[model samples]
Target: MGPRFQNNDRARLYREIYEQHGPIAPVVLPGDVPCWLVLGYRELHQITSDPVLFSRDSQLWNRWPEIPADWPLLPMVGKQPSILYTVGERHQRRAALISDALAAVDPFELRSHSERFADRLIDELCGRGSGDLISEYAKVLPALVLAQLYGFSDEAGARLVPSINALVDGGPDALAGRDTVKSAMSTLLASRRAAPAAGVASRLLYHDYARDFSFEEILEDMMVNIVAGHQPTADWIGNSLRLMLTDDRFAASLSGGRHSVAEAMNEVLWEDTPTQNIAGRWTTRDTQLAGRHIAAGDLLMLSFAAANGDPQVRPDRGSFTGGNSAFLSFGHGEHRCPYPAQDIAEGIARTGIEVLLDRLPDVDLAVSPQALVWRPSPFLRGLASLPVRFTPTPKSTAGGSR
Candidate 1:
């Protein structure tokens, strides 16, 4: 809402916000749009759990009249036919269709694709001795893998990386980036419809419930699926890599120790989650949450980072989470990220990190830990660049071992 939300020290900012305003604090977003920031772990869980009271439909927002057509946050909170805003019975069917399609992805094939992309990305920097992990590897890897799974040609997928990055960054180019992504997905859907193929796009188009929704609805769902799938997974890779390089606890991972990769990733979800806040649940009716009075149609932003850090739940905030998986980095409830989608994201992120460590056994941060910068986004948290230096090595040839 304020500069503090985009600041690098936002972890401290969340603590301050919690200390000042309790669980649900009223805050203003860009363009002076006011909403409540839900900071408590239990409060967020309760709001997500009761989708009936806290709905996903953006039309229920009370401040739509005041929100200008040119509002920067419009792209995020704007109502659409996409599954993101869908609710109840139809939403259930759509979720099932998407889940089944994604679940059909062979885990071995998924890993194989991920490893291939990861190796290719690393190869781009392997000879340079120093490169930015964010731009060269983390920022582009997930989209490439996801694009393949979604039926895009390698060339088209390669072109999609920048557009996806721009769209999520919410920069001046965001609208243009959105347009590009829409066009690309539209083309892919049309192609798949004319001649069905073995990919998620084709699966969604020919699914059992495909008849229940229009072509436009399925198109929007595909757009949401790709955009939603890409950015956070990219951030997850960048954030996890940053943690492994900066924290001594994960130092062993750089030397081919595989166990620490999972630990570092789990720790990032608890401490430095990719999705810090989400443009979230709107109250369907007047209700009380964490003792805060709420009117019908009030917006409640879900602060995943804050909830994960909530003192009530995580009493020892400074302690490592180890193998604990209770963190709310992923939203909870019926509408939370589908289990299959979560698996896909996890496979992409984990494989990317694992492949990098295996390839660059001597990699270390090129810049001082303090010199690293985080991207300026109120809703997402990720490194702007992750420069690292390692011994120069030869690039992998096609079909090389991963």
Candidate 2:
């Protein structure tokens, strides 16, 4: 067999490919899955937004044994004919229901909850002086929020983060281990059957849509919310912290300036979005993308990092300031990330980081920069551990009594 799926330096690889091949290149995955990687801004939009030529449904590759029948995995969760994977009319309806939940949530209430969670997490993290920011703070905050938003209990929320992490960090072994995670998810779903939280799951479980969705379908949808929304959301916060701490100018813009923390995050996200690559499809019969022919059935891989940094679309921008349009860190078109309204996800993230900055504004790295380990995952873009010593700030009354 060819070498096992080794973790390649994707940052360097992305830059080189874009420079050399000019965005779209035919490459074979280890499993011999042939697809084209789209590295330019325009092509990514064309391929991801298209539903006809490209399919989000894993069922398209059902005959390909190397790819699981669950090939599309978490993205395919909550799949009614109306689910995201479903096309045309069905896709639209399911997307609408999901969108309604996002629209229905009170931004103020969401921000408040996010702030409280961040404060609690920071308090715990501050005590350490140094810890794996990802595990200690970053992972818990967003996962818990997503869990609450998706109608799981506080206890269930606490546990679900690990289950979600296992899937992302554990690779093929963990993907194959979904049965274990599914068991816990089932109990939570069933409990919600009786005592559902007032959130997305409850809305979908009892909505007019409920008539068609089975328990498994609902559980799958819950999985999507947990994995897609929570993991990356939290990762971005942790990653942003690392960036601010390392890059002096970027760091100063956050710590010393009048720039809104949201603007700082937009800069970090422009410089570094969590999603490195995404696999997607074309909607029409055939198309030319980045000067390459794309037939229906051709899969498209989008490099968010490359596109975000593309010299053409990305303006000659400096540090994020007000009245600026940053890169598409949340994505573009119909499937853009629906969080951070007036800073929703960033509201949560900034709450935590602001507290950290205030507490230890002039912290120093505990170890050499090169010694820090980056999270070894393809999708997530962040460090695994961020060790820094800082001068702790005075405890705030809003921060719950320790």
Best candidate (score: TM-score): 1
lDDT of 2 by residue, 298-328 (tens): 5566677777766567545353434455566
Model 2 gets an lDDT of: 0.63
- Give lDDT tens digits, candidate 1, residues 249-279: 9999988888999999999999989888888
After the best TM-score superposition of candidate 2, give how far the Cα of residue 27 lies from its true spot, in angstroms. 1.8
The C-alpha lDDT values of all candidates are 0.89, 0.63
Candidate 2 clashes between residue pairs 3 or more apart in a chain or in different chains: 50-283, 51-283, 52-283, 53-282, 53-283, 53-284, 54-282, 340-344, 359-393
Give the runs in model 2 whose Cα sits over 4 Å from its true position: 1-12, 61-84, 171-181, 195-197, 252-260, 282-286, 315-323, 339-343, 392-402
